[model samples]
Target: MKTFPTIETERLILRQLRPEDSVDLYNYFSKDEVTEFYDLDSFTELQQAESLIRIFNDRFITQQGIRWGITLKTEDKVIGTCGFHNWSKKHFKAEIGYELSPEYWGIGVMTEVLREVINFGYKELELNRIEAFTYPDNIKSRKLLEKSGLSEEGYLKKYYYVKQRFVDAVIFSIIKEEVTNDERSKN
Candidate 1:
């Protein structure tokens, strides 16, 4: 955990977020469609992306979390990000979150990324559990979590107050043992 890990998949490279990625991050985050399910409003300025990059990197440095900037292997520009947040080493658990450019939606990009990230969480981080929460209306996210092998646990009412109002969330979780059993079955 001393150095940030870089994960690569067949068509993508998940790398550390750098200051140079602000423009790419801003391009998508500036769109209302991209932030519709996110807690933050559509970004209005470049500095907001810069601050977010700093915050994401800070989390890794503090051992609180890790977020990877997603890019295609042929290009360095970030199209989106995914990572673990609310990590608790003592509890051996963390929350997973991700967002991709709408352009990449329904194309299996996030699915591939989630597969690798989830494996890393269980193998490298030694996490016993990884969970995710999504706004109840986010059908795509809910489907993605299930496709990635997480089971829906239940609904949590008024879990977060975002955009000035309380909102409910649906939770999903996957355990290390479940993943192990899955890989065994696949083999």
Candidate 2:
């Protein structure tokens, strides 16, 4: 099994999740707009948030997957989470997922975190391909993924059954050769 490193970016630190992060997780995830596009259940209760965080921790060692708490260095606050989830070891692939507070939207925080996490996936985990699917309406996230070097692979119709609806998804990917050490170090 591969080990997870605490990745640091320009203004962010992608660290392991902790039980203490429940409060900030509840604050951001409770916003309907924040979780609306992501695949998480509605964040209604702090207990539910804690449960999810616990599962996130459990997945790391048990499944060889990664779930990071994105903390802003300046503020020392956990504003969001990101991960390579739903992994297929035989296929050498994983689905990339992330969520951030509405306040940090469009500020490139997610992009920085994406690069760091993708590096870990490619360099450490030996993943051959990393893919992510976003709702068609989530232009901000789509743009961030593209700008961070994952290309738009396709648009899937009604790809995800989320929130009791068949939501369309836009998929993106980063192949192993693409996550070059030189390029990853710059971001």
TM-score of each: 0.99, 0.90
RMSD to the true structure for each prediction, in A, is 0.6, 2.7
| Candidate 1, superposed: residue stretches over 4 Å from native | none
lDDT tens digits, residue span 102-141, model 2: 9998788888888788878877777899999898898888
List pairs with backbone clashes in candidate 2.
none
Best by TM-score: 1
Candidate 2 Cα outliers beyond 4 Å, as residue runs? 1-4, 181-187
TM-score (C-alpha) between model 2 and the true structure: 0.90
Model 1 gets an lDDT of 0.97
| Model 2 poorest 10 in a row by lDDT | 177-186
User: 1-187, model 1: which lDDT tens digit per residue?
Assistant: 8999999999999999999999999999999999999988999999999999999999999999999999999988899999999999999999999999889899999999999999999989999999999998999999999999999999999999999999999999999999999889999
